[model samples]
Target: MIAHVLDIFFPPLCELCREVLREGHSLCGDCAANLKRIESPFCQKCGEPFDGQIESHFSCPNCSTIELAFDFARSPLQAAGPARELIHALKYRSRFYLADEFAPFFMELLEQDERLSDLPQNTLVVPVPLHWWRQQIRQGNQANEIAKSFCQSSGLPFLPALQRIRRTETQTRLTRKQRLSNLHNAFRIREKMREKLTGATVILIDDVFTTGSTAHECARLLKKKASVERVIVLTLLRG
Candidate 1:
């Protein structure tokens, strides 16, 4: 009654299609029915999904040669269609609530990977840091916002475990090499937080994992500075 009347006055639109979502769904039923998650047969080292073909078993073209610093990554969905728009809205449009909306989905998504079940205790969840200057311009760090919501819901402590020391423009059109170079030495462990990270495992959260250069660099610094034991990157999508 009253709730239905309110729906007439203030309907909630689907985050992806902008259609009216019926009651509790974020995506309209049709959209939800078709949205694809990253089902397995994925690369063990990099988390890229595959069809289990021989060709699909190869190391990702971008990361084949160099050793990846982090253990592995877990992404909730394929980075396309509705997932892309949803990520962009949260990353660029400042739609922060989706961070909370996506957290449980990420938790479930990660569970499908056998490695996630044995997560070591004292594992700290950290967001890839944004430069203070750009964070000022954007009014906030999206990763931090996501990490905050994820921690509140999951009971895992969120730590400001990484700091950005430089600002780079968007990485949208950059090559993987360019992305890697641009992020070089851009992050460091804060001195006060350094002591707490020794031998702790970490889960680095970000809105998307594209070339993974940014997360790689951050994890590299974490290992070098704080002696953290393991780093697992987690994101809503792998673009």
Candidate 2:
């Protein structure tokens, strides 16, 4: 076939370093190994990584005051190194294939975490939604792609239950308060999907976690409108 012929003439390169891959994949093992992973001694509520030896399950200074709406959130890697590169490639560069490479890190975290491993059987996986305009501009939603890939691998049900009702300014430079205000009432549960969320544990999915304002807004809407029992956020990177 033409595809096979192209492979023979120019074998697929690793997406990160452009090294010729023995097989086609987003990352070579070496680049994957170099990604900076988040370790323990993190806040029990927000999953913010901390330094030095500390007691486990304690709230970090920020979470102690801020009070996240979700029960907890976690990511396998920090938003740096190859992790950042992969996220940028997938989100901004239209490399849809990277979702396959990014999802296992989330699945592995779910498998390894004692709390996340024992979620209620009624847990629902929901991706952070993109506004219609943004989705049209981007040509696809990277978060949905990553969430669907994670759901497939983890045997969880994937739902496009949340919709962004308003377009908000980018949160990159926004203060925490500004980000919260910007996203207020921005997300709503789809009417048909509302009935399914009653008393269900919700696992909100996104590509990255920065101030967590977006996740918090989604969780608030889920709890207020759908009466979701619990909310746990899982993102590929903690920014």
Candidate 3:
């Protein structure tokens, strides 16, 4: 009741549509419904949507040789339009409330994507981390906020299994090679916690899967340090 009164005074609005809403809602219903899901016949490796169904497991011709160590990857929403706007709001607007509003969309993909459906009920959720300095400036890391909220809602374990050892420029502004080079030696497994990760099947969580370099590097370190069986990457956006 008090919350509702506050909402009446302040007027909650959807980040995507700017429509006024009742208390406890972020994105309006229609805007939420309009979010696009990634369709089938996409790249097996990078999760890039293709025109039609193709036969190869290795669908990414460009990065196939690089070999994403993860078992599979998926971005529930294609990064464009409302999807793009929502992500920017979360990343720049510093409104983690959006992720709490937006997480169900990511979780809904589990029903459509077989890989996500098969994730073990007890799986560990690990969000890709930003360097401590960047996190301070940003107030919070977007991926960590999403993963933490998801864990709380789903009753899954949230793990800070990886760390950004060095600061790097934003991947958005860098070329593919530059992104890779910049991220190299940028991550390290928490030393004492290595044993805990040995047999763990990890769901590597992030906000977006742009070039996949960051997720790739994180997976690489997890593979090398922990001898983990599989590292699956999950992101909100596939571009």
Q: Estimate each model's TM-score.
A: 0.87, 0.96, 0.91
Q: Model 2, 1-239: lDDT tens per residue?
A: 99889988988888878998886376787887788888898878878898999964798777878867898999999998778988988998878889988777887798788998788889989999999999998889999999998988888999889999999988888899899999998988899999999999999999999888999999998998899999999999998
Task: Please give, for residues 1-239, the per-residue lDDT of candidate 1 as tens digits.
Answer: 99779888989887777888765446666665566788766776677877765544446665677777887887878899887887777778888777766776667765676788777788899999889988887778899988887788677888997889988868888987888888887888989989889999899999888778888898888888899999999887887
lDDT of 3 by residue, 173-193 (tens): 898878988899999988776
User: How many residue pairs clash per model?
Assistant: 0, 0, 0
The stretch of ten residues in a row with the least summed lDDT in candidate 1 is 53-62
Best by lDDT: 2
Predicted structure 1: lDDT: 0.80
Candidate 1, clashing residue pairs? Answer: none
Where in model 1 is the C-alpha error above 4 Å?
A: 1-8, 19-33, 52-58
The window of 10 residues in a row where model 3 has the poorest summed lDDT is 53-62
Listing every candidate in turn, what is its Cα RMSD in Å to the true structure after a full C-alpha superposition?
2.8, 1.2, 2.0
By TM-score, the better pick of 1 and 3 is 3
lDDT of 2 at 136: 90
Measured with C-alpha atoms, the lDDT of residue 99 in candidate 2 is 92
Error of 1 at 81 (Å): 0.9
Which wins on TM-score, candidate 1 or candidate 2?
A: 2
The C-alpha stretches of model 2 lying farther than 4 A from their native spots are none
